[model samples]
Target: MKAAQTQLNRYGAGLAVDGAFGDGTDSKIRSFQSSHGLDADGIIGPDTWRALVTGSSGGGGGDSGLLTHAAAAGKFSAAGVTWASSGNCSNRNSTSCTSFDGLRQASADGAVTLRGASGCALTITGGTETGHASGTYSHWNGYKLDFAITSCLSNYVTGTFAYSGTRGDGAALYTAPSGNVYANEGNHWDVTFLN
Candidate 1:
């Protein structure tokens, strides 16, 4: 059997990845399973693994947010953060195939705010989690911002983001006479970038 913690982390859920199923990890796991519609057995299995990989079921991808995982699920400006986008058009080329950005957190509460910059006007990939006031943000410019926010004290917080993208117009244009391309199929929502 796998150490409970490993399974949880693998699924994109965040919880410190300590490799030990401690009380904190267990509670987090249960919360994650509950959010993802898992069994809540505090054990990682095939079904749970799938859910984790898909990032469609879980509590902020497990612990942190979506910006931390890419090949699986999951940007920036200021403080070394900037948004960037490239590749085939999506969102009418307003969002792009990928975007990069970052998030800022309130020191007192850890509530995070984010923004990004990119080249693509359309978005080929993007997603957002309306945290019960805490979660992450993924922009199609090849960027993801994560945090646990109950409330953002400031009107506009500041932070940084990094990003990149593939070369193609995405699924819609796959047959549109493009040399070679693919959409950002990755789930893009696994861990909370709280840290």
Candidate 2:
């Protein structure tokens, strides 16, 4: 239990590390499990332990939001959605440059179960380096993602995919098809994850 506490703390569980698996620890475990696409049963099994130690099982990058390709690939699955990438981007291949929060929001939005589509599907057209302002920008820090309207599920309409947060704490911006938030880049929606 002490080892678990220490490991969970290292993984940003924010527990006291008191060496006991009490209610607080259990709640934190469940939250972590849900964020990582685990069963969320609050039981420290081999899979949960592995996630806590390695930070690679699903979306288990902890609070840092660092995501590996393997982790990002499985994040949507964890959220019970199907997604694909449209182009080769440096952030998609890097182990330490992806945004777990952005991926998480994407997965959450993807799991909405669109009415007319076969299922909820999303296509990632841009990431970190692929979409950003020409000059000073936040994408260089691996906090942005771009999605294409054509690649999104047929049922998803611009301005219908709802999310919260502003540019300061990360936001979803739409362009070309409808509303605008930050910049109008054309035919794409940009989502910036929390820093």
Candidate 3:
């Protein structure tokens, strides 16, 4: 049961990972089964276990080269960024609303060919919450991230940054290869990877 919980959480169930197959875990299992075209019996039998472990469902592999939640939390430096708690904005509505993969991809884009001599870093300030009115739909699906440019090669602007044009201090919006949108939100950047 402990192993199952761990795997489910790792597979993006957003469960507590407490090693107990309580109601919450059972519900998540049923959802996973339904999505994967299984019997949806809320059972962790061989097939379900295999899917959870292998990420056979469409949700496991990142959109492109983005990192998984565990990978992002464990190896943020490799992605050329640092994680900071956004006060109440970190997990405003729920912790599960924040997409770790979205953060990883946004950070990767932010780090690309930095213009200034300083090492690039984006301090995450908001993710998946209602504290900010500007977020709206982007943050509602656990696919949006808000981060500020802590350090950069130059005074990063919306238009000059990679993957986007210009939107002044409002937002430099750019669509990624996977159709995810990244925007500049004044003091921070908002990434919406919901495709």
Candidate 4:
């Protein structure tokens, strides 16, 4: 808790490094989450911890927010979600594997949020895998995810979320209230969960 408090302080959260997850710390966490474009739940999950320590979302150069202790497969089962791959692959070093290594905690949380909000049976079609576009906020960097498109999920995203213009590739973009970007890629929704 003291480590968290110190990191939060680095981000200008003026809390005493008392090693206690008190109301003050919680409030500061929520505030930091809000400002950093994370879900402000005050729980200090992986995303929040990364943002606090890295001083940014999982963006820019370097390995600040890299998921050294990445969650393994079935990690999302607790959140009532599952994953499938086209090549019958798993989360590993293979190019076909739907690996979650280095995936930002915030992005994973955003997936959980989408599943709960739309009440749709979602399947994660992509993760920190190869064959995705490269960038500072690219999939390999763990700032994005791809979920298979379901009719229910598509309707909820298109009907409920606000239109935010289109991506350079012509995919339609929807902005969630949490500042995440959902790009309609026909077969899937390429989601970019912000810091």
Candidate 5:
């Protein structure tokens, strides 16, 4: 069970790997099963275990080719990224703070790509903390991040990436070939980093 929890965390489920099959672990198991095309019955049976171990529905491959997991702010800083918050909070447990725990590695890599490509100073204003919309691939779930806007980033994202039209809130959208989505949210770019 501890291994299962660890594997789920590797897949960005964010469950505590304490070996306890609690509600959070159960929910993450069900979500992983559903996403991997197994039965979402919340049962850690053979099929689900296989999928969890291999990151695939069936057997054959070692991993699903999607590398993702939780990371800290220092990891981002080491990657040449910075963060800020309007409320000036830095605590991860605080809703008003900019948190990065459970932030998908792919998301951080995407930000690195953006910073390198744009040659701009990228400041992340939001992360896997609260205050964003709720969804399966939401900020709280580690799939999304919010980057503070700058003229250089604006020009690069708009000019370099392909425009995918505007979002529901009328924010201009851009998509990179790596399957990451960027929405212009006025003061920041709401980026959804996909694997």
Candidate 6:
């Protein structure tokens, strides 16, 4: 418990490094969870504990915003989730995996298409895949990305958006998608075009 307290302090909570996980520890945990948008159940779980350690250790991008301008460049260095900017090619690939733009480029002159005609069946933490919108697909251009993703082919990926209005190309909040991935190896990420 003392070691955990020390780690928590290092993460920026600065609570007493008592060896016991008493009220102080519980309080500290709840506070941290609340700030990080966790469940705040006061009982640390894998996700909560990981978030605590991540914030304290600054593993990726702790308490501070998950990937500041990084979202625009397709980066995910933060401990928690973050909504990325709007655009098809703005991000530079935050993860080591890959981006739709790169795949599209390799396709028929940089044009990526889904297997389904319109809506199939998909979900993410918060939204669902209804359809798709395509155009020039410039990087950082927000688009109204409707989803109908599934979890069979693959899950977990980037949702770089390319919107239509004059809305600024940036993230607003951390939203969960109902499904993780869409059809045709595409991931279901709630991408929006801000105006």
> Once superposed on the true structure, which residue ranges of model 4 sit more than 4 Å away at CA?
1-72, 91-93
Once fitted onto the true fold, the runs of candidate 6 whose alpha carbons sit more than 4 angstroms away are: 56-195
Model 1 agreement with the true structure over 1-195: per-residue lDDT tens digits: 244555544433345765666787777566556644467897767766665455444445343333322212121111122222344322223433332222211110111112222111121133221221232222222223322221220111111121234324231111112111112223221222322
Q: Indicate the worst ten consecutive residues by lDDT in candidate 3.
A: 108-117
Measured by TM-score, how close is model 3 to the native structure? Answer: 0.40
* Model 6 lDDT tens row, 1-195: 776676555433446776878887887776656555566688777776675455421344332332222221121111112222233223334322223332211111101122121112322122111123344432222223333344531232224222222223332232224211212223343333221
Worst 10 residues of 5 by lDDT: 63-72
TM per prediction:
0.30, 0.40, 0.40, 0.64, 0.62, 0.29
lDDT of 3 by residue, 1-195 (tens): 878877765434557767777898888787666644467898888888886675443344555434444434433332244556534323445553443533333433333222121345555555544544454345534456666654351244333435656556656676655565667665666666554
Reference-based lDDT, residue 81, model 4: 66
Question: Which pairs of residues collide in candidate 2?
Answer: none
Q: Residue-wise lDDT of candidate 2 within 37-118, one digit each (tens)?
A: 5788999898898876665454444634444444554444433333344433335345333333334433222222221232
lDDT of every predicted structure (CA atoms):
0.32, 0.49, 0.53, 0.75, 0.74, 0.35
Please say which candidate is ahead in TM-score: 2 or 5.
Answer: 5
Error of 3 at 87 (Å): 3.1
For candidate 1, what is the lDDT? 0.32
Query: lDDT by residue for model 4 over 51-159, one digit each (tens)?
Result: 7665555656575444432342323553466787777775545668787777776676577667667778888888888889999888888888888898998999999
Better of 3 and 5 by TM-score: 5
Off by over 4 Å in 1: 1-14, 57-195
**Which candidate, 2 or 4, has the higher TM-score?**
4
Our tally of clashes for model 4 stands at 0
Error (Å) of candidate 5 at residue 187 is 1.0
lDDT of 4 at 195: 48
Alpha-carbon shift of residue 19 in model 6 (angstroms): 1.6
lDDT of 5 by residue, 120-163 (tens): 88898898777788998898777888988889989988888899
**Which candidate leads the pack in TM-score?**
4
